[model samples]
Target: MRFDKKIIKYIVATAILALSLYLSARQIAFDDLIMQLQGLDYVWVLYSIPVIIASNIIRALRWREIHTPLSTEVKTHNAFSAIMIGHLLNSFTLRFGELARPIILAKKEKLPFAAVISTAVLEGGVDFAFLIILFFISLVFLSEPLFKLLNFDSVFQGSLGIFIIVLVVITALFFIYRYRRQLWQWSKSILPAKFASKLEDSMSAFVQGFVSLRNPLFYFKMTLYTILLWLSYALIMYLVSFAFAFQSAIQLSFIDSIILVVFAGIATAIAFTPGAVGVYHLVVASIMTTLYSITSNEAFAYATIIHIITLLVQSCIGAIYLIYEGISTIKLGEMKK
Candidate 1:
């Protein structure tokens, strides 16, 4: 029997998630894990929910800002609803949010899909750049802890390695943009007429997606929102730490939360499973246990609690928006096309 590619993707992703779950829990003592859970202060968990929601809202707002150069008609509510629904989809399917978000936004705002998609691509690039910067900063301040967590001989080696790769990529992209017309002409000379035209069309659509980046004001707003969004994440981490005994016993400071954010961000970037489920748990639990000398049970409990809170909150909000936007299964299929 023939299997669909998506079915295959899901199978692989699920297998990875299962392996991650096993690895994350293998060292934990279940009885101790339960005790750790029982001792958690629910109040701090409650406090984290709003901050989590606010971060996503901030992301939606920044997405709306990205759309401004193309179409000012995109409403904040629609943007929020669309991206939330996308996040909801991402929880179950790998990378589906990245694909579905632009379609949702385009349909809701009555804008061209290609134009809307360009903005999503731009948003991703911008977020990745910010993550790199934060990752570098975290490496500087928490090199010892990170080394302990990753068991690396020298953290700077990996940092510099990634920095070199990023520099190469940026240089290549700069040259590509600078000489786009000549490259197009060269391609047109060698390619079939129909293929060349299609390539040109795709390139034009991709370029249109980044129109907002040209505005200095957009950069200012983007930087501001990005800072606020990451800060909210760090804040949520801080609040959730209070629920764990380690917070009071060893005093995991705000810097500790920031450091954890860096770890979580790395997990998010490299995650292969849906919603980064098992990958996030393992990375976070590892960081906690390795850096703080916490028991495996406490570390896993901490990781699981925060992951559940964020997942539950985003999923619920996304479900509400999914209904509000009237995105039925049929529409989802159409968007996939």
Candidate 2:
């Protein structure tokens, strides 16, 4: 049944990927795209290399901090390797890295998998919260263009609807956390004693992973890392914006880079396909063409180059670390089990 479900998921992903590729490539001219790619400006992209690398480093640091409350002594190199491995896996399958990273890390570090996975869960939640905040901020600055881009009739209605939904979700989570003890008691009352005992152990480990969220110093440190991480992302965008042939046609300011990164970040986060392949390109190219006055070919070229470089860099880094850690294909497969 699990294998069947995995096959179904891959089929759905492939279909979506095909549709997105067709939509993005439909109006683009191959000749123009090639010309756009040929217009030489590799220097700026070279400048973005360190920033790209730094972003992932900061992410690994943040992940380490997330694990601090669990009292797990995860090596920095191991954490970094695990994150890159996740990225490498995610390039082929949507969300597969999320599961694989924790499993691999737990095995290497000799920690409980459930405990390590809870930190991953916390990392994801924090990232989603950050994205939501950034999205709303971008909405404030680029509301008019974004409204037209999305074809929303009323900006107020759309914003209010989204805000309410976010609020409700946050409130629900808060209530659950606040009343967790009571909820656990209720579950214990309903479940068999053996299963309830197991649940208690798992819940304890999970709760321990989030203990750092209660630390003031950790919160401040994490906020700084998150800010630096996103700034690195925006900086990379700004640097690469100069690499394209359309720089003379459309000037991208720092604020424009921020807005672009915000949208791209949201697209990448929510996209379900491998490495957000077609979805990322479409969102990026659409924004550039619709709002930045960049031609479709140039926009598509820019998106394609960025995605390709990102995938190559991440895959290379991950491969190196996998070798360093002696993580073979068989090892990875065994980790899944």
Candidate 3:
């Protein structure tokens, strides 16, 4: 019997959801975990507040840098509003924020969605470059025991992993260049005529999405901003490690925290669910367990708490900004055309 691809996707997604829940549960007993939380440092979590906000602020500035070549300049506060609300909207909805974020700026700031999306794509390169630098740096200083916890060492066994990453990146770049025209043609070829026209309309607005690499200053700023953002983020993660007073067995340092954070972020960026539902917990738990010798239960406690805190805090903050700005985020999405 034939089956629908959409149905298969949902089936697999559901399976992943189940797996995530099970793994999370094994890390902390439902009731015991709740009790453990009562003794936990709410204060420690608060310490992360400034770091988180500063990181996002830097990101907003970095975004502007990425978009500099496109004749669009976003003020920092305005950029923060876009970033926060977009983070909220995207957390709840899948991939919609990717479009919604640019559209909001395009409307309020009179920028084009294509230009903003261009900035996002251009910014992606900065993210890639920084992650490689941080990951490799961690690998150089860390021993096999510590490397297991950060999850970078396994990715390079017998040189096979390094070859694969290089090959994949090169292959991706080549195909992008090789199939540039065909990518558009392929989109047009598959969809119905009316839908194809709409797709073309959307694709047309993608002007600044990939061309921002032309200027050295723009790339330099992108790199600088990304380093700032990730470093701040890693600092927060390291603080979280210290908060427990029990991470001695985990054996992580400042740089090790940096490596783990980078790996977890990249893994979750490709996650099956919004906010990297399953991938975040799994990657984090594995890092703690393998590298730090953290028990699965303790790792889950750390991962789940961090994930929930980040989402709840940011989303609530973003919602307030949306209200203060006097625009309904849901309604903002309706203006997509």
Candidate 4:
């Protein structure tokens, strides 16, 4: 059954990637794309390397803050290693990183696995909130173009409604889990004694993971770190644009880079393809061609180069970390079991 599920996930990821590639190719000529790739400026692209590394470091720091209130002994370097391993896993698998990240950290720190997983869940929620805020900011700046591209009136309204419903449901579940001991006793009146006992223990640790939120100062620090992490990402995007600008007619301001970054976030959220492969290229190329008046070939070339270089750099760094940690890809796959 587990093998079947893995196969199914791969199938879905392949389908999404194939679709995205088809969409992107339909808009660009292959020969033009090749020509653009050949003439690309390498220097400005190199500038994004240190920027990307800094972003990952900041992300590691932020994750440490989230885990600190739970276990003060959690080493920042260990957390950073787990994060890089997670990203490396994510490049090959669909969100397997979310599971592998906590497992790796829990094993290293001797922390409760459930509590570590809960911190990861909390981190995702915070990231989602940031994505929503950035999306709205992009909408404000590129209102007309986005509206035309996305039919924002209907799409945004529907998406907003669904987001609100999901938020409410999640908040209610958090509260219920927060009081799981009492709830477990109540459930024991009807549920099986063994099941209720197990559930109570699980819920307790899960809620304990969120104990960090009770510290208002920690919350503020986490928010600040999150901001810095994203700023580093935006800076990478801004710097990469200069590479394309030198070779093509694709000069973009920092704000424009933010808009593209927001689109990339949306693509990652919606598409399950490994490394957000084709989905990112399609979204970025479409936005540049439609909104910025760049040629389809130039836009696609820029998207492809930026995505490939970022993927290669991060994957290489992650691979080295995996080796240093004495972990292998096979071992990461075995983690799911």
lDDT (10s digit) by residue, model 4, range 1-337? 9999989877877988899899887868899789877776778889999988888888778878888867787888888888878888888888777688888988899887788889988888788878788887777665466766667577778578868977898899889869976876677889788987886787778877899888889778878988887777777778877766533454577777778888888887887788888888899888888878788898888888888877888788878888898887687667656
lDDT of candidate model 2 versus the reference = 0.83
Q: Least lDDT summed over 10 consecutive residues: which range in candidate 1?
A: 147-156
Per-residue lDDT, model 2, residue 120, is 91
**Candidate No. with top lDDT:** 1
Model 3 per-residue lDDT tens digits across residues 1-337? 2468767766777787678767656556667666656656667777877787888889888877666666555677777778888878767665566666667766777776766776777666678767766666666764466544435446557246766887898899899878979987987898999999977876766755566666767666676788789988887787777656456555578877787797687666677666667678888877777776776666777777777777776788788888898767557757774
Q: What ordering of candidates by lDDT runs from best to worst?
A: 1, 2, 4, 3
**Candidate 1 backbone collisions, by pair:** none
lDDT of each: 0.86, 0.83, 0.72, 0.81
114 Cα displacement, candidate 2 (Å): 2.1
TM-score of each: 0.93, 0.92, 0.81, 0.89
TM-score-better candidate, 2 vs 4: 2
Rank by TM-score, descending? Answer: 1, 2, 4, 3
RMSD of each: 2.1, 2.2, 4.1, 2.7
Question: What does candidate 1 score on TM?
Answer: 0.93
